[model samples]
Target: MVTWLGAPSVAALREALHEVAPQLGGGAIVPRNLVPDAAPEWSAATAVLAGRYVVKFAWAEPAALRIRHQVRVLGALKVSAPWLALPAVVVASESPALLVTELAAAVPFFDVRHLVGAGGRARVAQDLGAVLARLHDPDVLAAVSAAAGPLAAPVMPAATDALRRGPAAPAPDARWERVAAWCDWTDRVLGPAPGRSGLVHGDFHGGNHLWDERSLRLELVVDWETAGPAEPEYDLRCLPGDCGMELFGAVVDAYERVSGAALDRDRIMGWHVRTVLDDVLWRVEAGVPMPDRRTAGEWVDDLGARLAGFGVGG
Candidate 1:
């Protein structure tokens, strides 16, 4: 659902069409591969049929639960956020573990280059802030949770433990120690959940949204498989890094303005650190090439410095 690369083999495509085509209703549903070149190994192949419908199958058997949950999330969002353009489900199945949806023609927000310019960046930031505000509205969050049920809880401390104990990286580094320290900081600072929570798009980075560059509007918020109830700022961590501090501030200001809630910089920073730690541990365990190790270390170091400046960390 985020994005994908690579192509399915002839035999694989045939099997998928045979299994999925029938359930999608009557039409000439010719399948076209949609994965981009240079996709990550874990990326799944997506097929667009008849240029109007999209068929996304899980790359592995383990993804079935998330795919099914995405169907429910989209269904709920359709009713809850009518103005937002989202893919409507045509058919969903467990055996092939595929979800068919109406095709949406738009560029992923991450791919849009307009944000490099000052004026365009500010506009996009404000627009995105407003959209996030709408999605995180208390009533909307309640409705989405009621429809989709509780989502998986944050895998923070467990991920920290894994990083410390996992065989691939058994030797704990200073960065790992910082991660553990931050986890403790988070616990102390956000003790017993201060009652400010809402729907969180667990993997809500820019890559998960589609944007219309021309209109400067959000076309869709895709990849709802990770969505669930959590702290309101959980989704803020998704903002792309290309945006300068000025633009980032504009986004937070707009978000607070639209949502009528003050943004918590400390909590947001904590969540961001937790996510980075979790990702590093997952990659180490999975044997995937770790991404920008030095950059990640620098980021955490800077985060610790920031927290220390604010008297949240020693």
Candidate 2:
């Protein structure tokens, strides 16, 4: 019984917001794409309303589905994990796939990068670890599952096609061989299915988190579209690459202490390996530019270095 509204331009979004919540529609509507580099026509978009609230809407069907899913997930978490610093949902609509939330005065982790020292980093890591522990708790997961229905499975890398296609352009045979060998090693390391699974913030990355400036406390976690069930390590996959191995270790240490559970380091490394190569494969095949314009071989070599840091020979 939902009426679909096609992708909305700034004006269209304003109109929809006005229709549902007139208080939010009068302010200046500055559009921001939720997905980086995506066009307004096909991307999920957000707009800041008078610096007090944010209105999110989808332009495409997939984006719309995710928006609806996020609303449900957030509602479930509100009851299950009330103490978590999550955004306050002001209002939402299914027909237009729009969501409105009160904007918090917080910034992404990277925004406060200069303020963090070794001690500061460890504190942040500990806070993150504790949060993850709660999110992964059996009680919370059960509550989320009961309210949100089934959670999505972990997304493993589909490197076979990319391996067959080789690099975007012809590379030295050694590069191809190295890539293939690394993939094989990862497969062997990953081996069988993971013994532990939990509800994970499917896209838990630095950018998705917001922190209070004065306290450096995690203020809010945005973008719940990808939250689901998966190997807990999958949530930690970006820590090594994004925050460096030291912080990665710190987070793991704190996580162990808080959760009172030992994590399998090899499994964590295996997930990291898959995550890095998945990025390389996607960019190579889609002709998207790699970060810093680095060549595929260089990217692969970097992955090897990261693996070696974990005492895993690639």
Best-fitting candidate, scored by lDDT? 2
lDDT of 1 by residue, 1-314 (tens): 32211144434544565666654444444545434342343334566666687776654433456676677778888888776656667776655556777787777876774454766766777777888787778888778777767666433424434534433644234555656567777655555564576776677776677888777677887777677777777777545243434566678888988888897866665566566556656555655554445444565565566556546654
TM-score per candidate, chains pooled: 0.73, 0.88
> How much is the lDDT of residue 265 in candidate 2?
68
Per-candidate clashes come to: 0, 0
lDDT, candidate 2, 1-314, per-residue tens: 23334545777777788788888888898777545446543468788988889888876776777788788889999999998879999987777788899988999876875576786988888888888877888778789989988877645666544653565645523555656666676677678888677888887777888998988888888988888888787788877776678778888899999999887767777777777777777677677777658787787787778877776664
Off by more than 4 A, model 2: 1-4, 34-42, 160-165, 168-177, 291-298
User: For candidate 2, which ten residues in a row score worst on lDDT?
Assistant: 1-10
Task: Look at candidate 2 and tell me the lDDT of residue 238.
Answer: 73
Off by over 4 Å in 1: 1-13, 23-45, 48-53, 59-62, 88-90, 94-96, 146-184, 192-194, 240-245, 290-314
TM-score of structure candidate 1: 0.73
